[model samples]
Target: MEPDSYHRIYVERTLALIKPDAIHRSEEIEDVILKAGFAVLQNRKLQLSPEQCSDFYADQYGKYFFPNLTAFMSSGPIIALTLARSNAIAHWKSLMGPVNSTKARETHPECLRAKYGTTDLKNALHGSESFDAAEREIKFMFPNSVIEPLPSREETEEYLSKHVNPTLVRGLTELCKHKPLNPCVWLAHWLMKNCPNMPQIVVEEAEDKK
Candidate 1:
């Protein structure tokens, strides 16, 4: 699809990570995501090195908790997923509940973290807080999968020809009309099926509106 055509569709993207603690609890985590309506753009299991962990959390480098956070992140393998949907960041964060496990346990006991997280740093999952963050995180975590340099008109046309079938495109357009707050899984599936080459920014813009 053309960039302008994609803008007409209302798309959005976010990044989500199922931390080491959730390795044995993949089924449950996946259930929460499926129910929430996000599409998985790409997913991988990665065991981060201490250096990688530090770089990934660079913003928190000098925090009092930095050392512990880095160690915990490197403790085991983690699953990273590029999620697409309407209101992806907000929806993913809501599903994750709160940053503080104690609060998550008390106020949102049904959340993913409340069910699986051991501490604030060992939280079973992580999500991008905004579109910009999502883009950066996705690039950092999946550099090979990252599609840089916007697709050209010919590339877009070829992508549309190969992937964006009428039935799939119509279904996503209908989904956009539903106006749900989260709707990530639904959007993810749609993108997987029809708009695989759609830019992350285009997807985010599509879902930006309430």
Candidate 2:
């Protein structure tokens, strides 16, 4: 057997959706996400048009529940997220559990869908099924966004453990532990330090000012 040149951890990004039926539970879900150690790269809320919904779920276009699914998706506002973690695509799906809420409740009662989903069509969340789909969905939700290619686990872990994690812990600890005036001002500065290419208006404006 030949040895591979590089170790690929598939330390990738994935798209997560707080569907209309569960957008009300967004805060709770996000808390779970942070506690679970996933990094939320970006997020936005929008109401999709029926046409947009159809396009997004094109793979299911001919399915029996397609119409109702599209209608429900377009019915209210949804929160789209670009999340990053090692093994993100599969990990997010595991967190979301089954597409069928009833089955999810039966088998994975603590999963996001089991707790919040109402039905298969009105499932409380959505996760891209694969790395390719995740890239597509993240691009769809965040046009003009650039997701940097991640390094392998060996490189990431060594660097983070030796350099990144300590600094981050100190910084985040300071931010959370102290009550500062206009905390957002400090947070914006922190985000710039960590994510200089975030594609946010604030990032752009800061660059322009510089």
Candidate 3:
């Protein structure tokens, strides 16, 4: 099921980038993310090529910081996470603090960047600044992400209530318990144990009738 049906209730998803500088502290940062009530919908550790990094940050092109920013982004492996929450776009950015992390440390000591970042170029995290940017960034990171250009209201509501809400509750409950070191690993085990029978949907092709 697609996940973009939240114009009314504000369930949103955003991309949170754990930049190269913070890759070493990935687990600590992830613990912070989970404790902050954000769900990790998808996670991957990938090394971006220069071209990919440039295209991803195209909006900053021609700016003074663009070249250095892109170079840093492509320098090493980084963690890309699809984080979801009630207001994920803003919430994730708030967790990341400002682009310049030395200032973030002085002002917002609890922020991710402040804890892990050394400089603006070495900033530990990246977050989508707006709703449109969130959507576009998610697509850039996950090109084959399910297309939900327009999800029917009723179906979307049904899916969320039936699947998303309950799983979130259960996930949160597990997170609160004495658990595995890795949240994603715990989730994988939970899914394998619980999902005995996955429903298979069959789309019937139309046929001519006499």
Candidate 4:
């Protein structure tokens, strides 16, 4: 195929959580996810601290059930998944059905909640509500990843060439010549001191003595 004839397909990513109540059913839930066509990009099982649970659901902090919700979430290990698909957020939301398990069973019989969830607060799974929430939740769960809305290659190259490369080259050269025991620390200090936009520290000179 000709270069111009090629088309790029972009995939969307969202965060999914198998909360404590349904943690034992993680493998089954994952099977459902894969069957529904979502690629699990990252998966981890971890127990959240009470503080972490509180922070994760910060928006619901003042609600009547907030304390109990946090307690339940921190009670056991939950599985965090980074799901990718064309519309992963909406798909996962549909899969999870209503927040209440009773409602889910009545209205959406095939949903995950209907099968595993106990109540609204103990909903078996959680899906990101929007793009911003996806980004935040994904970052919270997987700290090392770089996510969407990233700068293009051209933009990244331009920035490195204009601002970073020159200083980086000089720093590396000095690092090689001096061979400091703490090379990383030395390079960091060098870059800070030699940065193009670093603010000047103006020291006032005392007036000449009479």
lDDT per residue (tens digit) for residues 1-210 in model 1:
556675434456778999887789987787779878888888899899999999999988899999998998899999998887766788889999998777799999988889889788888999998667878899999988845534444665566667766656676686889755667777766656665465555434456656
For residue 21, give model 4's deviation from the true position in Å: 1.0
* Per-residue error (Å), model 3, residue 177: 38
Selected candidate, larger lDDT, 2 vs 4: 4
Single out the weakest 10-residue window by summed lDDT for candidate 1. 196-205
Worst 10 residues of 3 by lDDT: 1-10
As a whole number from 0 to 100, the lDDT of residue 28 in candidate 1 is 78
Ranking by lDDT: 4, 3, 2, 1
Over 67-155, each residue of candidate 3 has an lDDT whose tens digit, in order, gives 89899999999998889877878788888888888999999998888999999889899999887898898888888768354344466
Clashes (N, CA, C under 3 Å) per candidate: 12, 0, 0, 0
RMSD of 2: 11.9
Q: Enumerate residue pairs that collide in model 2.
A: none
- For candidate 2, which ten residues in a row score worst on lDDT? 1-10
Which residue pairs in model 3 clash with each other?
none
Cα displacement (Å) at residue 199, model 3? 19
